[model samples]
Target: MSFQQNLQSKLQGHLSQIDGRFANVKLLDQFETNTKLPRSYAVIGFVGFYLLLTFLNIGGIGQLLSNIAGFVIPGYLSLKALNTATKDDDEDLLIYWVVFAVLNIVEFWSKTILYWVPFYWLIKTGFLLYLSLPQFGGAKFIYYSFLKPVTDKHLFHESKPASKVN
Candidate 1:
């Protein structure tokens, strides 16, 4: 198994022995769901971090540009989510897009110590929860976009039927 899967397996084993094993499982499941969901905070975090890096300008236009970029990546990711024929894909993508768009709007216009500090704390805390969760659903989006396509192609190649000899 891959390093991450091995680590997750070991961690799950250890966690299952803890006092509140079931609770931990439920929580991890929730987290995994969230991570897999399209346009979720993981994607937002990546895009937001990128925008912050790219923009050094302390102006309205810079803020607008960043917000636009943030919207595009997550939105695109959400769109790509439709490729998954799984049952939960639609709901997950919906949740992600809605939350992501709303939060991105707030983050975009936030300025000064008053808005920035508390909002930063709030978003940061949410992000921390996201990161701390054992299984984040948002991870699925990454896996699907980057890994699943290749894996699927390998697993299910296009085939042709053979003619019957009558």
Candidate 2:
């Protein structure tokens, strides 16, 4: 086979593998069927907690929660993704959360300007709601459209070895 044809065949195979891996990731369906608690209850609880953080202005509790939401939980989910054989919806969610967390951290560092913005907390809270609520499929969309392309390119590169000099 020509080099071009062989490379094209390999690329197609990799694309097929990625498609097969993500074919069964129905985020909304998984959220509906897999959880023991109702989705509304979870949403209410999260909103309530956020309200408390904002209204009461507790010491470091808000920061702690932000850390958990942005980093700890997402890191756990990413680890879970690595361990699972199927790489299900959680994997997609993790990608979204991790990217969001990184961006949030960058924003956090610029709190002086961000704090002056009107309804900043409200906007951030809404974004968090969209991310955590599987019904929105925000995470799934991000995973498939943005993260997957970049990640797949790196993955393909990593799988191939460098040529050795004679």
> Which lDDT values do the candidates have, in the order given?
0.51, 0.62
Q: In angstroms, how far off is 68's CA in candidate 2? A: 2.9
Residue runs of model 2 more than 4 Å from their true location after superposition: 1-50, 71-84, 142-166
Model 1 residue 58 CA deviation (Å) reads 3.6
Q: Candidate 1, residues 71-121: lDDT per residue as tens digits?
A: 555566566666767757566556455445544465557645434453344
lDDT of 1 at 54: 38
Alpha carbon lDDT of residue 9, candidate 1? Answer: 100
> What is the total number of backbone clashes in candidate 1?
13
Clashing pairs in 2: none
TM-score of candidate 2 to 2 decimals? 0.44
TM-scores of the candidates in the order shown: 0.32, 0.44
Error of 1 at 22 (Å): 38
Model 2, span 1-166: residue lDDT tens: 9999999999767656654554465653355368864344444566587767754446645545554555555566667677778857666666676668655776869988556865455455556556655567666676677767887788655432453432
Q: Could you tell me the lDDT of residue 149 within candidate 2? A: 86
